[model samples]
Every structure is written in structure tokens, then in C-alpha cells.
Target: MLTFEIMLEVDENKSLEGNVELVPQLTLDCVIFGFHGSSLKVLLLKWKGTEYYSLPGGTVKQEESLDDAAIRVLKERTGLDKIFLRQFYTFGKVERYDRESIRKKLAHLVNPDLWYKRPISVGYYALVDFEEVFPNPDLLSESCGWWDLSDVPELLFDHNEILEKALHALRLELSFQPVGLNLLPEKFTMPDMMRMYEAILGKKIDPRNFQKKILKSGIVIKLDEVKKGVAHKSPFLYKFDANKYEEVLKEGGLFFI
Candidate 1:
């Protein structure tokens, strides 16, 4: 288990500082969401010399856009490039900087005056192929890996809120986008698809009904191949038809399965 230590800075007024004084320094935090087996998880990095877990993030370079910075950060931390990443929301609360955990973790590197000032952060959310990504911790992080979304420990600053929002967005995307394809392999079985959907929706779907609905959707192309080495009869493997999937997305088709 990981434990985060909270440190508070005491000012002359002995009150937490406001964001008006700390808006100049900005950081970009990315919540990398992935699905493995029947579980949903997020990638988090452990900061060096700190016990806290944080989203894989970095500061924007002076010459770069926030998007580019996020990509760079993701590649550096997760060994993933050209992934499906998106900017979800910006978090700029005055109390964001006043958190005891943040103040303590950063106190040694910054002056007390600067530590108390609030810095606005732009939060980006990314959906990556988990098995394809090899997460690498950067210079600032001691380690990096996936943590089950439902089992995440205490996160630093306002990261908890950002992660929650990312999960909410993902659930909503399940209804609109062919998101399950991103999490699955190039070729997968019907049960594999059903498991991924059930993990995201957090419900027990009727297996037979699910198979019927998905087959009717006509977005899945059945291959002439069958999964090998099973005790029972082999199940046919299927892959998403990218063109048809896009058309369904454009038409806002419902994927009840």
C-alpha cells in the first residue's frame, strides 16, 4: 500500500494562499485510462521522494501547445505514441494549491511564498491499448504502472476529481464510440467483447442477448477462423469493421450489447 504525506505551509497571516498569486505556473495532468481483462484501470506515477501517486503529467514547454506536451509526457511515461488522447477539462480552483499534501510534497523545491500560491492545471484524458503500452517512469517518478480504477489509493492534489471525471467521460463514450475496440486485440472472441463492455458498464449483461445484439449491429466481421485449444467447440473470432463502425458512430447507433 502507498501512503501520501500531507505538508502545510504556514504564512505570516497563517492562512492558505489564493490562486491569484499562483496562476502563472501551470501543469498538465493526464489520466491514462486502460482496460485489461475484465478490469478498468488508470496509469499513475509515483513521485520521487514522495509517497503519493499522481497522474502521468508534466509542465508545458514554452514553445509547445498543451496537446503536444501531453503527447510528449505520455510517450515519456508510458512508451505510447499516436494514441487516442483528448483534453477533458481544466482545473483551476483557488484551494487547489492549498492542499496540505501538495504543499508538503513541493515545499522542499519551492519557496514557501511560491508554494502557497495556486497554479491552474489543465487535465487531459487518454484511452490507450493497455497491453500495447509499456509504461516508463520519468526522472521525477520513481515508478509507473496501472492501478485498478475501483481500487485507487489516495491521490495528490485534485487528481481524484480529475480521475472521476475521466471515468465518467469513458462510460458516456461507450454509448457513442466504438471504444471497446481500442481496448481489445486486433482479433478477439465474442466473450472477450462482452467482458470488456461489462467491465466498463459495471453490470451483468445477459450473454445470449448481448451476442444477438452485437451480431445484429453488423459492425463485427466474423473471420473464417476459430479460437484454438478450448475444451468445447471453438468459438468464431471477430474483428470490428472500421468503416462500418465509423458509419454507426456517425449515425449515433445504439450498441445495446
Candidate 2:
């Protein structure tokens, strides 16, 4: 039995290859959300030599803080050093520690004993600009890419439940958080923002009403520019006023969809 004190004394800054030490009985899973082509997407890693997929996740190093570990995992998978990330929940259900299932999927990649140790996982969600992410798989996975939220398949371990919880948390935040600042590009049309909201909220919004409410909040500013190179009439481009958005958030102003 590996004791907690023994696990904490292991070396830090080394790769996760062969008996690398990590904080005992604790891990994290990240649900990375992005928006593209009018669809909400989640980043997933395809296991090497298997058809199964899962969210990008990792264990906390002995010397690493939880936030630092999550940031490192996000950077590894998305190639983004910074983004909007938050801890929403902790999953420690006894049944979540499905050792046999983990063995079937990841035994060849990581220590077989790993699954038997840590059953608790900290759940985190991140919002990133879709176009900026260049997905990279970990050592155990062969491919990394996006899957539409509606199309995501059953994931390894309890990740599907984790993903569902993340989405639920995101929807709750949609009413007050400036989610678009991280998920959308610097410049986007009003419709693009609405689509992102609708996708996450799982419903449609009145375009005119959405425009009026969002503009009134002063979080977004209309530019003199319109989207270029489309056969149809181009929509005016809008950019988030980061300063004002933060100000409103500080003031507890509502962000209605």
C-alpha cells in the first residue's frame, strides 16, 4: 500500500512515465468546450489502438497545486497556456472507481495499479476559442480532436457523467457569466454569439431580443466593419469590451440571453 506521505515525497517535474509520483488518491478531468460552425464542441482524446475516447485528464504531481495541474493538462492538450477554467464539482462516488473498466481501456498505457488507487476526481471546465486550439494527444492516445456536443460518444470511466455535469454548470453560468469572451474569437457577429448561447442553453433565442439585451449590457460594441467574403449580406462585426464586461460583472449586472 502506497501511503500518502510516501506519494508526496516523490520527485516532481519528471514525465508521467514509469512510477512517477503523484498526489495520492486525487485526479482531475477537464471538459474543454469550444464553438465552431454553429456547433458546440468538446475536445476528446482517442486511445491508442482502441476505438474509445475520453476527456483530457491527468493526476496532480506531488508538488503541484490543483489549479497548476489543471492548467498544465489544458496546455498539453489544447496548446493554450491560458483560458477560462473553473472548478465546478468533485466526484467521489464509490462506484466511479471502476477498476476493471479502466484496466480494459488504459492498462497498457499507465500503471495498472493507478486505477485502483485514486477514485476521486476534481471536475473542471474550460472555455477556449475554437480556432485557436490545436489538439494534442497524451502518450496513451493516438489522436486528439473535437466532437460536437450532441455527437459525443460514451467515454472511458465516468467521463460521460463528468461532461454532463460540466455542461449543466456552464448553462447555469450562461445567465451571468461572460462566457463568450473566451469561447468566441476577438471579432464575431451577433448571430455567432447567439448561436453559442443557444447551443449551450439547448434552445433558441429571438435574434432581435438577444441583440437588444446584449447591447444594453454594454459588454459588446458594434464595429464599423462587417464580415467579409460571404455570398449573402454580411453581418456587422462586434467585439466584446473587456473592460466594460468586467465592470458589469463586478457590479452584479445580469447577462440575459
| TM-scores for candidates 1 onward, in order | 0.83, 0.89
lDDT of 1 at 249: 76
TM-score of 1: 0.83
Q: For model 1, what is the C-alpha lDDT against the true structure?
A: 0.76
- Which parts of model 2 are misplaced by more than 4 Å? 1-15, 18-20, 106-114, 255-257
**Which digits, one per residue and each the tens of the lDDT, describe model 1 over residues 132-251?**
889898655679999998889988778899888877777777767768677788888999888888877878889998899888877899999998986798999999998888788778
Error of 2 at 39 (Å): 1.1
Q: How many pairs of residues collide in model 1?
A: 0
- Give per-residue CA lDDT, model 2, range 107-185, as digits (tens): 6555445345545899999999999999999877788999999999999888999999999999888755778898999
lDDT of 1 at 151: 88
Looking at candidate 2, the ten consecutive residues that score lowest on lDDT are: 1-10
Which prediction has the highest lDDT against the true structure?
Answer: 2
